[model samples]
Target: HATHCPKPFYSSMKTQLVSAIHLQEVELDDIEGGNDPADDKKDPTYTVEEAVETIGFGRFHVLLFVIMGSANIVEAMEIMLLAVVSPEIRCEWRLEDWQVALVSTMVFLGFMLCGALSGYVADRYGRWKVVVAGFFWSAYFSFLTSYAPSYGWFIFLRSLVGCGVAGVSQGFVLKTEFIPARHRAYLLPLATIFWMLGSMLIIVLGMTVVPTYGWRWMIRLSVTPSVVLLFLFWFIPESARYNVSAGNTRAAMETLEWIARMNHATMPPGRLVESAQTERGSWRILLSPAFRRTSLLLWYTWFVASFSYYGSVLSSSELLEKNLLCITDADAEHRVKHRHEEGSVCYCIPFAFSDYQTLLISCLGEVALVPLNICLLNVVGRKLSLALLQFLSAIFFLLVNICTTMLGFTVLLFLLRALVSMNFNVVYIYTAEVYPTVARSLGMGFCTSFSRIGGMIAPFIAQVLMSRSVMYAMCPFAVASIVCALGNFLLPIETKGRALLVRLCPR
Candidate 1:
């Protein structure tokens, strides 16, 4: 008898059956007798070959993960450039501190508000469509944001590009759904590593663009990733797990065969669930006792994290004072002129010219974020690590106010931003893992929406400090960070190595 499925996933029945048949055939004829309770109990038991064939963990999985990670980096570079390019932007436009902050705040605001609905649609229709929309829209608008001639157009375009991030915000969850539960913790961290690489490029751009051509060029430079890395979309396949759950047999086979070919193995033939049943999917299920509380906490966390984060970045731009430093040095303007005078072959090369140092520092900031994320997630539990970082970030915001010297201020500013960057990465991974399969999309969307609300308000908050001392401006973010840090303490579960839940709502 064919097993039944939830109404929402009714379509994936065939894919479910095929994958089941595939797994069962292998279980039935285990060459290594690996399924035994005693032998499988050992954590070290999974041989590299068996991991590839039986469990679907291998170079192929790594390849897909890397591609996804790099895609994330391409997007991140655009985001970080917002912070790096602010100095030139604020100076040229003669804008206030809040105005500069508005650029990134608006982007996140666009992401926050649109995320929930996109999550729902992805759950009902497909993950691939969501990613496709995000890519096309973000890439187009990101380029448009660069071309904006006026401050109003600049803010409008940045927020519009933010809409693109909304469509693709839950990529971690999508990747989580496709892979096995056991490897998820490690996989999530690895995927974020791509974000690190992308951020690093902006740091490189910072070294080259901001000092020489000015901040507008940094905005123009960011357009490279959105256009170039888009080619990967073709190679990116749909979620096999989503396919299996929806009962699409043909799609299941095609995706599985692709996986097999990617790994060089034979397809297994077994039942999809052996006895799994389902009913049509519904949003009501998210409010079930099992998930409601988790959803609420995640939403709140996103709000606080977003508000505090962008608040700091926007506020930091006010602190750059590089132009001040340049004025003090006198020699600085000559340096800028010297580079522009020479031009061309040396221009594109960041390290080739002297003006690129600030850009280099900004781009290198991304590298600093990498190991920080890996260590925190792997060594410390999610809750403590996030809370700790948020708390520290908040402290740095306040400390930036107290510092007397320029050198002292910039050093603390970079360090705190690095710590917060790590926290931001953790929030992405943890939020996705906390949700079950059914609510993952909406959960992500809702959480991001709250984040956008914070993003939207970050500029206003920054505006309050615009007329005040830089030290005073940071206090609000510091305070909010403390609140978020404390709230994280109440997160009920660790979710570090938990399984991806497949809740089949009974009819």
Candidate 2:
């Protein structure tokens, strides 16, 4: 076979080792008919996708996992902080129920305001810069929120915190850019463990600290990590794919070289492959024919996922307060009768028992769900995993209305919480995988912002409907879940084991 080939193909062995070139059927005919020796000698060019795929998964990916996972941790803590502290703020300020709900609504409204902007800027400028700014932005506002003199100031600062935390959504795109196609589904779901840990940490903190130094101190302490993450952000690199999409070929080459060196992988000797483009994408493109179906479905799914997840979490502290109080009361009664004292209590206030205990168990639900979610995503892929989880959550919600015993009600709530947590993990992974590099950050941001709309509405749902009946309170989420499950089936693409596209724009 070697003797039959042209002399140029056998002239140098080193080029063969360095290149992944292959002869297509069309090229084979040319080779046989008499092709140019000089053309073959010049070396083949590759696209950015081909070069990056060659580097495979290694050290650079692990660093991305750490940084991006840490961002999720921060976001989870910040989100939980509001629910944990809102009660205390209510008691201290004598704020109305509507006022407290407004405080929760404002945070997500702030998310709505800036979520798209974070994605656009990340796409246009770079991921690292937006993420760095997000860390400091959240930390500053979170710390300032701890010092708010009035309810108005508190709501304003928390809104700013929402805007700052919006940067965490960028983690999905930033990390996805580095991950190899084969490992995307498997690794992305594992990031939820950080979110689980963050949820647990806030509960633990609320249990331990809120009773002593107060919610203000807890907020202040939580902001401390922002400084560390901001410093660490300086060491993180930009996405090489983003570089290529933006037509920064030199920067793209440098990034690929750096990745290859760090991963101990080989780089091709000739120019790095890249798919260059002249113009950046706009949000309007999301409405175009290619993306319209998937985009709308993602928006609906995000909305339902956010509504169910946050509604279950935020309301657990309030809706289950009565059940928790009965348990606490029983223990207090036993201790008082036995010890013959004036009901020596476990916590500073009765409200703390209801708030902290429900919040703590709600977080535990997320922690327990992670392992199961990891398995489901790997086995079933995105659509079924999401549909099943949403359906299960709806069943749990309906059961919560029927349960007569306090234990059964709490158990069902936990199930609902866990299922919603799993739904969140799957949706985040799915959204990150579906869009190409050009529109990835914006796609995620737009969907995330729409989810915040659900989040904004959730407070009112819990506040209004739960007062009528548990069944009534849960109806919207149940309906939303069904809608989402149906929408999941309509998703145009199944991104499992698929290569991340460098660009999705028209030729």
Candidate 3:
């Protein structure tokens, strides 16, 4: 009666796969036909997005929020700290503005180079292992900066500091992966107050202490929080997501059950498939067409963001402009110095200060940055938010050359910075949301590592552009920003509401 070909099964599977594609698209039609969300839900095979759904509503939600937020501030301070102090550091060392700028950017470059290695290490070991290692490593490095022997030594140590920056991405992966999917947009940014907090910390330092004590004291102060946080991390757990990826079904289930208990939800009744154990991890996997496009976008995205972020922080006219004006009143500057160094340890003094922007603009940028970022990220997609900001920043930089009004340019500069502040906050959230649980941190670390190239170039370009005013140096960042916006269309997939293991195609 029935002599049927097997093509029907394949055809049905094909249709289902196609259907999943439409459902999972991050840009539009994301929730997809309002499928019975629970009917499709299963116990053990719960998707990554599903697991994250349970994250923020649970018992330790506030604790996670605080830790993650503090972590963001800590990491932000590390990256942007040097930028904040660039003018002062330049004066102390008798450095060309550009030369002092490299100290910070090179660390980011080092960060870029080591991402793949960090991710590989995360995969080989555990997400928590990397996170803990990174926290402690960076803590010690902070103290080391206080004693940097010379300019050459400072640069080397900064690069070493970048290695720790790479670790921070892995840490973010672990902390972020455990977060509830719904709260991700909010919590991730909330956690990112670290960037501003770090900035504020540096700002406060610069305003009160740095002028008096020395740059080294500010450097020491940067890591003090993380040093304290080392003990605070005592209770944070290893990632259930990572456990699932490593194919430890029992451990994965155990972790989820623990989370359920923490959330006061019933123990879930199914197995959690963290990963399907493909060769999802190698450099070869990264070179595939799908990743190549994404990698290129991420690489440029990282670089342009770094260029804009640090360039504004390190090279602008806000503070240096102030210091230059203040140099004329040597007694006041010296008196500020004396009060700052009251019972201070070191006496490293600048022979004569050079022109540089004060962080007044950056401070303004930070004050307004958070809520504005939240609006853009939550209302607009991550891609649009970042692209628009980057484009605006580049245009503002170019505009500065054309417009001579202090009021007009200052307004533009502040506007430009308002746009740039969104870069790091959204980028972390965006990157975390895009990847699957299995390759999540590794992918993030890799992305961050490549970002270091931008960070590294950030200083060089700012210096060169400041010295030469060639449009090409910084303009490439603008062009690159535009490119990333366009590229988002090709690689756009949202894991926001889907399961960790939902059916979807990569291409």
Candidate 4:
């Protein structure tokens, strides 16, 4: 300072002090490593579930939910077609009861043949590819079914439609992976409402078109949605979980990043984690000791669930036979008595129209179950909810045995359908939760194939038993419900409020 006396000296001294402070800050950042490039390259400390939760629910999830839910609509229509068109097809083809039942059987035959393979493919190749392929297969076959010239041709096309519809199972797994666990219980069941919607559509059309234009036109109309779904599915992405499970970290990262961007969220810096073991999915994995008990129980559950579900639906014709207002031979004669000479005058019972009406009533149970399921599942948990519903359904099914009047029968039918619908929702949600990511789709496929087994035989049960007595027709379904109720009580895994497991291999 004594030598400085000059202004230039003072300025130089100040600059030196600022530079020293800046260097000290740099040294501190190095010690903290906040700006270290190596830190950016480290694997993420968080899991996929954590990340998905961070991103949260938004348009991305809604798009997925709606698209997958629409897929459910096409599947619902296709599966229900056997019941909706059975009477018309039978009259037109002069089909025997066995043949009428066979129409329902063959569709599931197609499903049984292809369902496991579809699941494996989704697991190995990825979910989106199979889902799109399934859409195209279904659309083409569904449209083709309208032109079938004979019962054999009609059944063949329906089987093919089953194969196509199988994709929805995989689509369901993919959808589950995208959702945050917190919301799964609520949203997954809600998607099933589309099933109710699809069924209602079929009944509405059956009410209007089947009576006038015929069953063929009703089938043709069902094809439009599948075609629309093909376009929408193109916009969907593969599940990030599937990608990471498959070891394509880069692909998973990209998908997660896209999700983050869409969700207006931040991607944590680093790689996501999945089970390190990379064994390809195999059917055997589902039957391995660790999963063996779980697998057998699940299969049996699916069988009972499907048997009761489809048995009730496919037996609607027989149920309607008990309707107090059923068209009588004399009433039919009276309606056409004056027009005997008119070749177009018809004497057949208005089965197509009546079936449609009865099905509309069946849907009321489903509509009511929407809010009921939310409340019931939340309070009792999945295992208890399923058990309770199954037991309740058994009571309703047995009540059909003693019901002498149409009112009693209709009430029991409504109650039976409602319980079955609730049970169906619980089983599906539970199945998606118990299996690990490594074999989730395969497990679902394997279990679902057992459902097809039940579906395959249900028509026969209904055909023979319905012709005898109400008790005879309903005994098998009631028994199955009791078994399921017992099974639900015994299943150890309570999937409610649980995390999706990453690996299920033995420790």
Sequence-dependent TM-score of model 3: 0.77
lDDT tens digits by residue: candidate 3, 65-117? 67756776778778766755655666567675567666776687667777778
Question: lDDT score of model 1?
Answer: 0.64
lDDT of each structure? 0.64, 0.77, 0.64, 0.78
lDDT of predicted model 3 = 0.64
lDDT head-to-head 3 vs 4, winner: 4
Top lDDT model:
4
Full ranking by lDDT: 4, 2, 1, 3
Which run of 10 residues does model 3 get worst, by summed lDDT?
318-327
Pick by TM-score: which candidate is best?
Answer: 4
Residue pair clashes in candidate 4: 44-271
- Model 1, 150-235: lDDT tens digits are 98998888888788878866566666666655566567766655776776677677766666776666767777766665676677
Better of 1 and 4 by TM-score: 4
- The TM-scores of all predictions, comma-separated, are 0.75, 0.85, 0.77, 0.86
RMSD of 3: 12.6
- Model 2, position 274, has a per-residue lDDT of 67
- Tell me the tens digit of each residue's lDDT in model 4 across 105-129: 8888888777888888888988899
* Candidate 4 or 2, higher TM-score: 4
Ranking by TM-score: 4, 2, 3, 1
10 residues in a row with least lDDT, candidate 1: 344-353
